[model samples]
Target chain A: MSEAIAPALLAPGRTAGMNWRRLVPLLLVAPLVLFMLALYALPVLAMLSRSLLEPAPTLAHYAELAGDEVFHRIFTNTLWTTLVVTAGTLVLGYPVAMGLARARTLLPLLLIIVLLPFWTSVLVRSYAWMVLLGRHGLVNEALLAMGMLDRPLRILNTPLAVHIAMVHILLPYMILPIANALRQIDPSLARAAAGLGAGPWAVFRQVTLPLSMPGVMAGILLVFVLSLGFYITPALVGGPRDMTLSMLIAQRVEQLDWAYAATLSAVLLATALVIIAIFQRAFGVGTAFRMSAR
Target chain B: MTLAGRGASVALNSLEKRYEGFGAVRGVSIDIRSGEFLTLLGPSGSGKTTTLMMIAGFETPSAGDIAIDGRSVVALPAHRRNIGMVFQNYALFPHLTVAENIGFPLKQRGVAKAERARLVEEALELVRLPGYGTRQPRQLSGGQQQRVALARAIVFKPRLLLMDEPLGALDKQLRESLQLEMRRLHADLGITFIYVTHDQEEALTMSDRIAVMHEGRVAQIGPPEELYDRPENRFVAAFIGESNFLPATVRGREEGHVVAECAGSLVRATCTTNPAPGESVTLAARPERLRFVDGGWPAPPPANRLAVTVTEAVFVGERCRYVLRTGDGTSLVLKEPSSAATRRRVAGETAEVAWSVADTILV
Candidate 1:
């Protein structure tokens, strides 16, 4: 066993003979590797292969998708909604994350509150948004009773409703990473800034904000990539004019156009990966993380 | 040398800080001289750091006032006070390059960009970190980071500078080197530096005066030698250095010295804190002050003598420490420089220890 399993200590630059020690690591991960290859990668490859080889070995589906006016609108709509939802969650979550980092005694309860939304089903949460955003929903009815509204507001099935629901769903993803980052900051940095003649606002703008960039980048990456493929919230809450790439893919699949649906899915996956690459280029996570090292 | 500061004198009057019925500092007052380095030295929770924080305008005193150069700054916020402070953790901004971090204070004061750059370079050179301007703080070693923090604090040319155990995080060898650098920094800048540390040696080595704090109050404040040689109270005596305490009853006053009966011997010692006759007190004598009586001694064997048995003898490189037991079962230590001329005493040997009146303090 020792002769077969031992490293090539006696002979440098030589490969070891068949070793159970080396196989142990591979054996440990074999289940997960096999599961992903069979269930995930195989299906994804089969779907993508349909875009190129289904019914005929031709690129007609991709050529049509590029020139399709409706496809362009849906693609841009998806990009626009993803950007707004990311911005919305960021603007709202940064403060909550800062508060959560500072509220040490209340941290456990606050964390539970931040993570509570994940326990609810996405379909149920989308329905809850619908009930609250309908024509005679709680918001408009309250505004009308307060004498601030002259007529019923058209809020349901709008981009605003889609934005509200998406931001609510994706907020936890934004908050957790940012709070973890904020908690890692050496609090004395702010005090040091203040002592060095910086006012409160300058301290925040120069020290606190810059030091928390890694967390902010992580949050944006998570929320942006997640919202790019978001389907249920928008489908249940958005008007017909707010069709996204995922919605188009759903429509094509329902009409028995599997090749075009696969083409759209390929485009969505490639776009998401390209966007992530661009973000990485603009703000490398490694550099940001190293900058914050103690 | 050109960056020397016009040091501001700080006066903390009746400064008190209490949080939630717990008094962190109670009625502490100290008048700090300009260009003088004063150290607040004590154990943790002794209110040394609190006293420092109140001076830097970080903690609002529950009572009394703080004046910088005779101007009341009680209403002034920390940033408006123009006091530079170095925290215990260096506290360098992680995202900023060394130069940018140093230039931060100048930028905040609305200094022009060109001038700020020049001053940042000058400050870096002042801390011997020239050309490290573009390097981020994480790239520097712990000592280098602390020096950068020091440079940043002093670059703004604040009249006063405060430090809170800045060398506590470093190793002993690094701390010693930094201590020398700080003393030189103080001399070059000529700024009033208020430092807080629990290290007695650091306080004695660096400060023009040391304030020994205990339980929310300044137990004693004086020059290092004064605090070491003539401690006014038992706390100051015990806190500064090793002392052999002999419980005694005051016999009478003899020639401006307090005569006391201690450990089966009559002892004469200095007594600024006057003790009336028959009052119980403690006589504090440094170990080096006590000597072994031998034929080599002068005609009269000093003033006080005690019969003791050598309980233990420890050779600590330079000196031989003898732990002696008195007839009354009191243990006292006597340290003598190891010399080949004198015979060494072993445990269980009978010996007579002698010391002079001028060397002992009646506390």
Candidate 2:
């Protein structure tokens, strides 16, 4: 009796020959898919099409972007800043991630601190950094008061200020993924390694570090991708010359040069996509989603 | 594969692990002889795993010292102690291939790469897996993963190998097979194996000496046969196998055994310590040891007899288990082989159950 009922119970739609049941899961997301197509996909496609179609269908804007020395310098500076910020967040984030994974009692408190940055607006945080990094601001004032600096230093409008603020803002993106990865590791693996004659450093290097690589990769990808599109943080805290691709695109849009802005935006989007594709191919992008979703 | 004379004698002296207001392992001290397979067996919260962890150096004892080969190792870290350990879950590194996982310890010890490969291959062969070097951990089944974990632990050639319920996650058939394989491996390597498991049968099947634990302490430790035949206390008797306990008062001594009174009859039982006359004691006897005595056969002279009413009789394939009640209402189970020679008794039938004095123990 159980066997006879099991088939229908297991796949009632199949017994009824209702093929539409298979699409039910996909149908659940139909509304969100349509929403994305209208709000995000259509806008991106239209903007990308404008880069080629506007002012006569030509690749001249792309050619100019590739050949322009100023564009070259700005792109290089943006890459450098993104790399710096990625490394900065990683260096500052790993220990905290480890702490988050290990500290049972302090986990809730540590998690709050890590996620505290997300509660505030990015624009507000950038302005706050400007206040802190500005000449005679809190940092300089503290430095002067401690007699560490002879005078107020030119911290604002420099690459360092942008890096500091960006790292501070993007740290959670790096930390959460790493913490999730670390937490996923079975605690017995370390004990097993140690029992097999691995010392403390050896256990960390051989087991802990290797096991946490997924989170490390996830964090690096998230932080690197987010750092590329940063406009407000770089614009407010960066020096006049430390212009990123986003700020340059904003500058073109400000001058009503929509075609050039579209071209730059398209190129930046393509670069980010290429990086994400490479990351997805090398290390599963699902890990990033899983870790950061927590 | 030719691991012989490589075992280290381990002595845990008054080992204790306490947390907050309670003790996890309180005063567990077992002297494991070289090359002996000693299993700490008990149910959960019996401190068996905790005791194994302390011996492995993953857990620090609240007091007392651990010595390997007469050298105190309380100050040494887990790695420096050079003990191979296998966790219950087969804790193989997920990122590493089978060969890399096996060679991890050798790599840490700075063994040359070529030597590492050679050792890894030999270890794989030792665990009966060959040419499985590149297979990922997730690709393997639970039994295969456990084999890889065993290979990885033994590849380092640590003098002591600690296994924490390595077959706990396996099915019954697989667990039984692995238990035999572990026994074979222990005999082959002669490595001092400190195993921990909650399964009494697994411990009985594999160990040279079994330490039955209860309530964070060792209830009894002896050879399997000795522990089964002569359990020192009530916990050991109850935990090792099925036992029927009857409340009795010590009456007198007879033929080097203690005679006790239970349910208006005299029961002679072997005791580790002499109990004074009129002292209340419990007599433990195995179900299979009790037999029905009838008028056709002469009742054995040295056998202790009890008059009982057969309340329930169950015909289990090989044996008939009869639940009998004595005059005083104390219940007992008597197992009789289902042979054509012996007549089966039904409910409400009056009978005399007799068992040899040696089969009963005073606890």
Candidate 3:
């Protein structure tokens, strides 16, 4: 009896074979995971450790960050820039994302327009903005030709220029997630809302907006986190007084102040992680990433 | 319980819907009385759901006038029409709690907090889900989610309630139970219910009136028994239930019935249309109306008897279906109770199937 039961219970596909098949997926992923650990994880860990260990194993770097007025001002500037960029992208990208998701005939065209920026490198795009927004650039020329402006206007090398260029670079990131979220929502939900005596505005405010929260949260997180560590675009287009923390980190590294540079990088990384943790708690992590309302 | 005459009567006058010159619903004129349960029954793309959508103001009609309570509402949008609708997928808000979902309409109407809470609780209790208010819709089972959808649709007490295949997504057993519950609710509330379904049995069981649609037009509209027993055309006869059409030519007419020649025999059938002699006609009869008798072909064959060879006898639970073919190879089906008598005739045997002359329907 035991022999018969054991042979039947250990059916190949249900027992040993199934376990082996499961392990096959893990084995397939091993190479990529090991490569990431070696090249990415090691360097980030080393940089974070040097913030406490370079010259001495002390909390002095953090203490300096706590007290330094220049660091404080730069930190505030980084926060301000991230907030403005995130808000601007959300307000501008929302309608475009909605049109992309809902349009029947223009979807391919909208998609191409939204993704065209990604085909070009970010550095080239920043130079293109410089040429476009320059004192005598095409935008100014067009405006002057159309008699829409009195002068070419001081458009480049200002905080506004930095914001405009950053938003243009990050708008696609904001739009894609929101468009995906909106598309996942069943049109029947809106129809049901309308049938239940809700006006157009009410249906949008109550059904469409609430159902798209996951995408909005994702866009905010991606844009805000990306803005926090932005370096080159701001450095090229921003005024001197609009220096962010990433610029300070670069300046310190150029001066061979490794401890302060490592500290700044570590602080930025920690800030991003803290923000993610808070948002994950406020909006469940599943909802933050889930495409469907369910 | 407070709803009765408050329900609006809907009248569609020559309603027509055209899409790029193709008519989805063509010149459909129906007068739906207040507090009546009417079902639009048809196969998919037969324009039943399309008609319901037009009545709900989701699909604008190209040519028609729809009046609710004697006032034309074709120009009004869906929201202003004050209609409640339940979708096939039960579109409950996934993020909202059961109570919040039920309270959504009341909140939209600007009802106060205490009143909204009371109404939500009442609705939850009405749907037999009193303590499940705080649970999210995703946490509920499929049946519970459907109950919440029904509750949400009715919480505002709209003038008309439209359901588009609301139970089509449920399992058969659950669908039957919900059908009964829906009928009970319709009776208790006394509100007009315009339901759409492709299931014939569901329409027969719940509807006070059913409009059978075919090819964008209403083939027949009447009470369930009338549609089942006296279908207006061949499409209605075949669509409502299983039927066998026997072709014949009109021979003569009597006081209330017409005599037609079918397979070298005269078959007396009740015809809705007055057919002239020598005009072609088709006679239809349900399978259960036919019975098998001993003998292949008797001398002076009976008025409603046909010579058929039993090809297949399928025993299905309480009844057996016998597939038969005549000498000309025209197929006929006979359904009889699976008793000792019906078991005697096996396949590949000759049998005579008979029905009453009155049972033959001329289409």
The candidate maximizing TM-score is 2
Clashing pairs in 2: A157-A239
- Determine the TM-score of chain B of model 1: 0.96
Superposed model 2: Cα runs more than 4 Å off = A1-18, A287-294, B295-302
Task: Give the per-residue lDDT of model 1 (tens digit) for A1-294.
Answer: 475335555443444434545677899999999999999999999999999998889999889988999999889999999999999999999999999989978999998999999789989999999988898988889999999999989887999999999999999989988887888888888888888888999987998888788889888988998999999999999999988889888999999999999999999999988977887899986753443454
> At residue B292, what lDDT does model 2 achieve?
80
Say which prediction, candidate 2 or candidate 3, comes out ahead on TM-score: 2
Report how far residue B177 has shifted in candidate 2, in Å: 1.2
Better of 1 and 2 by DockQ: 2
Q: On residues B21-80, what C-alpha lDDT tens digit does candidate 3 reach at each position? A: 899998888999999899999999889899999888899999989999899988999878
Predicted structure 3: lDDT: 0.88
Predicted candidate 3 versus true structure: per-residue lDDT over A1-294, tens digit per residue:
663354456553457656665677899999999999999999999988888997879899999899999999999999999999999999999999899889889899889999999788889989999999889988899999999999888878889999999999999989999999999888988888788778999998999988888999999999999999999889888889889999999999999998999999999999999989989999975787887554
Q: Which structure among the candidates has the greatest lDDT?
A: 2
How do the residues B211-253 of candidate 1 rate in per-residue lDDT, one tens digit apiece?
A: 9999999999999999999998888888898898988899899
